[model samples]
Target chain A: MSTHTEDTKDIWLDECFAAARQDTTAAPDDLITKILADAGTMQQEFATQSLVATPVRAGLFARVSQALGGWPSITGLATASLAGVWIGMSAPAGLEGVTQALVGAEAVIDVVDQYYQAEFELAGDL
Target chain B: MASIEELSDDALLVMYANGDRDAARVLTLRLTPRVFNHALRLLGDRAEAEDVAQEAMLRLWRIAPDWQQDQAKVTTWLYRVVANLCTDRLRKARPVALDAVEEPVDEASGPVEKMQDRIRAQALQRALSDLPERQRQVVVLRNIEGLSNPEIAEIMEISVEAVESLNARGRRRLAASLSDKREELGYVDAH
Candidate 1:
């Protein structure tokens, strides 16, 4: 039985060694050269495109308009609107965390109400 | 010894990122052939291999700026990319009959030896195509590309034990497939 196991191991090892031998075939030389050439052309095109993309400057009237949501005199209202938008997005998380706190407060009120009921029952006996 | 004359992969990547054309040339010179060969073995098609190799190299060119320096060398990353791209092409490719092996042009080998070699290459290629994709990749990485288990694991995104299991299973299946040709495979003393 031991010899059988050893023989199996040796055969498997031989098979692995046979599979380990490597033979290769490469891409033609001209194709590699052409790929490089194409890459170079792409690089030139990318460099040229990046040079033309300067950030656009906002004009004075546009800047003010943006700040006030297009209002000239009701800037306070715009500020309030901005605050509303911010709160709408940010309020849910804070509200959820406070829910657990409110739950604790409710439990305290229930305990106090029960304590008063117990006192009333005891007073009635007195 | 590491040569001072050669720019490190990271440095070359930085240059390529900054739109240095020479950097692309240097990077291509370093990466293209290995990537091509890797794609070739996975797909067993020359044209597809070149396509995969080109796209992989171009993607490297595109990603150089964002690449972290401490990560694997740019070339190893390219090999992984090329392998995946070959896998993708293979999926999209209309199934073609496996190509016949061409006789090698070596002058000294006698005709009988050459014929036997051709037949063996053909049989092995067939058996290799028979392997499951993951197992085939493991075998190729271990046997053909000569990558270590850790390297294969990293590229395959599997644990080292998984790599070991895959290689063991793959090699066993491969040997079984080639069992009919044991004598011709020249495994006379392999056992």
Candidate 2:
């Protein structure tokens, strides 16, 4: 066949496909109802499984943890507490020195004031 | 909460998995026609098609909880399921009698045009039934269903090149088969 005839044949085939594309066969109402009924039964089974699987009353900590956004928040709180404990247990030497320096400054001020008062009294006595 | 209508098929399936009855209804309404039509075309039997469609949807419902999002399109998955079911049925039983398949009525066209279209469609269906199983599937998916070669490849579990080759062969076979009916189908003189 010539190319033109081949093109015509292809066009005709496409037209046949287009006609077939307008098919009206659908899932009947009875089939839909049956499928939906199956789904409903499955859903009920899932519901029953969920009801049976879940505890009726959660523990206090479990409830609190859930209220606080579940495992993530609990994990964060635990991490912060551990960090605080580490800081307290492993206090850096610099921090201890700073605390000691603050206490030493107060003692130094008291001693200087006492020395100054004694000097004033001696001058008065002279 | 978005209504089931606003959800994609995957989302609707997820909702159905969570026991939302409306999601199941929406998915059924959305998917059943495509499934039914595909099965009917493959098997050429309405009752068998109905069984296939129902079985396919039931499988969907059962697998909803395990459906991996983004892995595959819902329609593609369903098409594969229906195709496999039809193939099994075809293997187990004799071929469907073409005369038993009814032509669909199109109310949009005039009576004569509607009759012509129905006759053409029926002829095509009969011709399609004569094709090898894979060729029939590739042709139906590419032509009547308007799926791309790549999509058909995914559904048929083949490469795109393979899909193209199958489609080409199927079309050639279809053209050869339908050549005798061209004048009767009113396409010979139209050119």
Candidate 3:
């Protein structure tokens, strides 16, 4: 082993590096088999999760709810619909009185008469 | 669906996480060689290097579901994992079996050049092993592995300046160590 000048030293180092880079060592076949085996096991685990964890297809109502904006919005719409149905079915006791107070009976009669008069005029024109 | 070769590593990992067995195969084919080589260079023991590569890949498989694509490149993350695994093995200083260090065959060169290349490679490995761990890592990543200094810094979790300093010191040491062997390594004859 003899020492080289600085210029030679750089060239030698570069040569050595180039040689080392060229010396590519593949992972052993058995090692690759082991790695792939492990990956296979993980794949199975992932498969199991896919099978059990995620639904294949969301239920129709669930899909609709998700499209509309998830459970919160669904719950809100449900509550509003239920309230509307209750209001329509049960007609709370002071509702008519409240309506009469808000709009006099004469006002209601006048509106109905005006509606019938417009219908009669349209029929005559036809 | 894109073929495995057409997909990026990140995409392969995502597919693997989603239960695509072929994706796992593709990823293993792509990354195992790099991991094994890096580990072998760091540990200087074939069996241990294989173990390190396997363990590192196992961790990768485990973390696939949670892997954040924007966070790190897959190979970079594997390099970091292998480096840490090598560090832990070095710290433990386990007695490597005598048969564990197998010389790699260089099929690309003719017999004589192949022999010479092997010798030079062994000499460089010896010099690399003699370096301080950080310097060795920096030099290997920079010179042999052909990674940029910033990439080396990211893998080693050090500042780029520190990585540069380590690389300089490591190369200087390697040059000093191998300078005397220039003739024996056929550097003079080749020149």
Among all candidates shown, the one with the greatest TM-score? 2
Which CAPRI tier for candidate 2?
A: acceptable
Badly placed stretches (over 4 Å) of model 1 are A1-22, A53-126, B1-5, B94-123, B189-191
Residues B1-191 of candidate 3: C-alpha lDDT, one tens digit per residue: 76678899999999999888889888999999999988888888878899999999999999999999999999999999999999999889865443454566565766888778888888887777778778888878887888887899999999999987888778888888887888899967644
Q: Alpha-carbon error at B102 in model 2, in Å?
A: 3.5
lDDT of 2 by residue, A19-64 (tens): 8887566567998899899889888877887889887888998899
Candidate 1: DockQ? Answer: 0.11
Ranking by lDDT: 2, 3, 1
What are the Cα lDDT values of the candidates? Answer: 0.69, 0.85, 0.84
Q: Give a tens-digit lDDT track for model 3, residues A11-118.
A: 668667777887879778899899999998987887787779885787998899889999899899999999999988998988878877888756644545877899
TM-score for chain A as predicted in candidate 3: 0.45
True contacts kept of 1: 0.24
The 10 consecutive residues of candidate 1 chain A with the worst lDDT sum are: A1-10
Top candidate (lDDT): 2
Residues A11-118 of candidate 1 have per-residue lDDT tens digits of 533433333232345456776787688677767766776677655799998887787677655677778899999887888777766866878644544545887899
Model 1: how far is B180 from its true place, Å?
Answer: 1.7
